[model samples]
Target: MNDINREFVSHDEALARAEAGVAKLAATRNDRWYPKFHIASNGGWINDPNGLCYYRGRWHVYYQLHPYSTQWGSCHWGHVSSDDMITWKREPIAFAPSLEADRDGVFSGSAVTGDDGRLWVFYTGHRWANGVDDADDNLEVQCAAVSDDGVHFEKLGVIIDNPKGFRHFRDPKVWKQDGMWYMVFGMSTADARGEVLLYSSENMRIWHFEQVLFRHPNPGVYMLECPDFFPVTDKDGNEKWVIGFSAMGSKPSGFMNRNANNAGYMIGTWEPGGQFTPETEFRLWDCGHNFYAPQSFNTVAGDTDDNTDGRQIMYGWYSPFVQPIPLDDEGWCGQLTLPREVFLGEDGDIHTVPAAEMAGLREDSTDLGVVEVKSGTETVVAENAEAMEIEMTIDLKNTTADRAGIKVHATPDGSYTYVAYDDQIGGIVLDRQANAFGDRGYRVAPLTADELAADQLTLRIYVDRGSVEVYVNDGHQTMSSYSYAADGPRAVKLVAESGDLTVASLTLHNLKSIGLE
Candidate 1:
């Protein structure tokens, strides 16, 4: 591979070789993936994880590269390769938005290994043919790039041409079945409805539109983005199709108090020639707010298991709609949700439980069972630990605090979240303590004030060396973030402004990354 963006220069010598355009992002401070050697500088904007496929004895990942600017300008395909999907090696620029068909930028898509062993990437080609560079010309088309070796790709011209109908369709996910290939692209239709365009390809080349796999039932409102279909098997020893997509829309109330972006899954059977038996219904892929744009690679590639769910894992961009910080200084913006193990759980829902690989990063462990705190009381820090989760249940009967609950990563003096049951305000308040970025992140996402008025708080919070996630009441409510190092900790602090409370129980755990050395 050659340095395609030679004109672009970076401050760091090691990062300079990356062919990346932006400076190192101090976006994350702690263990948020600043390897002494590896090259993802820091912060800016990173979207769609493109060209995700299990190839060359490793999982090769290509993404829309905005390594230079943060606002989605002139994207090149950034490269990263990983054998175990944990530690990633940054590769050189694979492809950019140079072709006339993709002047606006090369959009999100998938990579598939052709029957001939060559890797063929099917992606959305964004262009403005009218010679106008305005935002209105962002038309969508399908294009391909083939790689004899998984690292480098060559433009293969347009494959599936854009036809008339919907204006909002894009992001094609391609895969093979019995020597032939198929693609599912998301789009908006003439009827103002969202649909997934299904297309077929022979010899991994010339294409044909098969049929409309799915539509957003509702018109004009629900535009689908990032449609992916993978094969899974049920306990009855039957093969099923898991077609999933993100419903791009505004935030709703309740759990919908989220910023923006959400994903869902449908697990039914696909008969290629016949119709797809849609799963009983669609369910949220991740109830959490940050997860979006999930792509999978068949870990057990080519296995003939009747129960086909291998490590069909997923990775998503954790998007916080109202960012606490700006992107101008930090050249990068987002981080991927720790890879998750995806499969149909007992309840017939696509269970996206965290990957077991994360357990390996555990450094130390502790537990506090049934802590008791009088009004205005807090615990002193115990022995230090790293990469952990603190699980606890509280009974705040007759409590008077306008605030109360466990304080995560609580420093000696600051940086904590006061999860409180406020009788005065009548809601749950996530009072975040002041930190390096200041205390701007504190905001209240209302909870069920009626159901839980009984004075009970059960919280399960995970504090990784670099990231933090709070899963309230067994995943019903969750908050996630990449906390800086100086600010990351495994300490526990409990407080209530008005009265005494009993900590029903507490358990601390050491966490780690799986399949990683």
Candidate 2:
């Protein structure tokens, strides 16, 4: 017998193992750095938000999960459901590495409602040739699981075998458009060039290869993972399509692509089973250090309610791959970025804003009206900085500072993460080198001339226990990263580096916990 056969377990046994592991960790896990509102794993590790869809009046989100340890291992699908997208309830583990096709692991994929009124999930079944998890030499194929109630899934085995001449193939994002089912798979040619392969099916089971939807122009990018394609309407009522994926082996350029891996998207035009023609160059989805593998909710799938309202809502893995996560020793690591509504901008680009339902989390509100800071001074905006939501507008027309913005997770010992607009670089900078845990570096989000011409810069920031997500100018740009302070009594401060600046308006809101504990 082969090594995989020797190690394989029945579906029931696999699920029991996962549940026992989670139960053991729950009894003694630490909550020091657990997020107050974000979707984090109960224990162990999670990455790559998968199988996002609006089904039966609830938002269903599945993720790549490894429940036995706080590290990456053989994968299972972790499940959660929400009625309003703000408060979530954990569901049973969805998929596990049980069958021969998935003896090694279950990777990332998407979900769609089948014609038979069942929720169908399509994912990659991975097996390493050397019989070791995460080994470089492996085989991957597309697989499916179906559920009538969205809680229990029945494995359908392999759906699409590995295609020839592809060294890497995985991450199937499936959707329906114009009465046909279409799927996109991230693949790398045997020659090591990254491309997105398109396929179509009248029914969800049988798929036929169409053509290459899009390819990375840069040969340096060896592979693209977690590809998502969706349509959005712009402010002028012009419809456009967007292609997004996470790029591995992407070289760093200035302040972009600095993370170990980067996620980006291109605005383009694509028809059902047709070629995708790009209208804009590739752009980073979030100019931050820890955002990747974003998946959008399929609003048209299943029996979705009017709450979605045809919005392209998305969630990303809020942790960087191949980086140190400080909370691993505490028995859990990784989180999901807040749900963002993506739309096509008038400038022919994609922009994301926090979902409207997020306002429901606000509790006590304080309006710190019209605060000004001198050239060499700083003003404390809020003393209770932990678990807060802050919105502020800086009057750039009347500002003369070289650098002006807010400092979050600030400690009295001169340690804080700074988010500011730098006049010298003409970009927004997120600096976390001052006594923060994990990776420490700065990232810049460059502004276009049109953006700089505007007289004000609006910022909406969410500060959790160990992370901060900043939305700039209503999500024309965003930065999401983990920043943990070593000392307590952290405060939020507004500072001017070289010259005076005026704050036209500022408000702080104490957000309520989602009761994840």
Candidate 3:
């Protein structure tokens, strides 16, 4: 194999080497835990998604790329495109750390379409001058690149420098509002309180700093990364703003309180003066074991006040734990979650459902209708399916069980991960403690009062080799997690803790691999 990093005079040379490396690995490597449908690095390493946008009737996703190895190092931008967000086409390395300004690495950012129909990318250029080990040595500046066509790009140099007195600053998320360009970057105060700084640009090149959009009030949070903001209707039929950020340090309170490395959003209203008025408290975006650094984009028509347009979509890095995977043997690690449609629920919460086009990947489906399980477990569909989609409705009102839901990824010995609705807490829990093949943890995300008031609950679950993503009540809530196990006759069962539990309807689809072959 060629040295991952050799001489690079131009972007083409770097791309050719990366392409060669991935092709070599694909020819001889097979990891059972490699996902069948998710987007992963072509060869080396990928982290937070950089730029995501719609161009010429397709969706393009750019991610933090280190083409040398599966371990973190200097960064570049890896490109992939999809017509329907299900099957992705890997493009060449779009942005690399070639320019003097970004010689160290090209970090995370966002993408947008210019008024003249050109595609624009905004990213942070990172360099460590004083020392690599000290956080005080970090230096990052916002930069821009332009592309006449979606595949090729030309660097435009540094656009914004680090403001005075800030220790770390990066991850520029740019969007257009009322015909003006607004940019938000993750930042922190000198005292180590995390916040987002706002800026406005009349032209794409020059930007003027505004004010701190919002800050984490908790003293335990040191800093926040990958901040994203957008407007959506709240549950009360009122338009509101949603801001999301990834936090580091001890777990904060109010939303999903368990995970120490927490990622969530706050529902609020934005004034024309650029200040945000939080309407409701902060909440967890996804209560999954491995979800972070989420970025969302609009793929179709714009969203209305009621969020009826159904075009807002999002994707998050599968995990930030940086644990070793079987695929490390092939010189790659990390993946992005499936694209989900985001909308404001009627209960003042942000909700996400699988993109509509995912249905196209369902090859053979079975309709298991109205099964009753009393104080036991029953296999409803396939004995076990690694890549499958299950949609079922549980009659919570009529059921007498204290707790009920489905058991998935079950081994023959009854060791399996459980996804169930806890009647006592009136929330959902995903237990992966027994499945230590990958990361082991339990995640619980609560449902709103309106969600639990219903007589029936609906669940849509997508399970691939190492991931389990569940959508509750048509995406009013969602939990996404990752796990691994050996391939065999795993059990897919309807579980009831006590008393009769009735399944109103169940449908299981053995999903076909999307571009995995």
**Best model number under lDDT:** 2
TM-score of each: 0.76, 0.96, 0.91
Better of 1 and 2 by TM-score: 2
Q: Rank the candidates by TM-score, best first.
A: 2, 3, 1
Which candidate model has the greater lDDT, 2 or 3? Answer: 2
Candidate 1 lDDT, tens digit per residue, 281-324?
A: 65555544355777776655533333233677666665534455
Error of 2 at 111 (Å): 0.8
TM-score of 3: 0.91
> Best TM-score goes to which candidate?
2
Runs of candidate 2 with Cα error greater than 4 angstroms are 1-8, 133-136
Q: Count the backbone clashes (under 3 Å) in each candidate.
A: 24, 0, 2
State the displacement of the C-alpha of residue 13, model 1, in Å, after optimal TM-score superposition.
19
Task: Give me the overall lDDT of model 2.
Answer: 0.85
Worst 10 residues of 2 by lDDT: 1-10
Comparing 1 and 3 by lDDT, which wins?
A: 3
**lDDT per prediction?**
0.61, 0.85, 0.77
**Once model 2 is optimally superposed onto the true structure by TM-score, how far is the C-alpha of residue 293 displaced, in angstroms?**
0.5
In model 1, which range of ten residues has the least summed lDDT?
A: 1-10
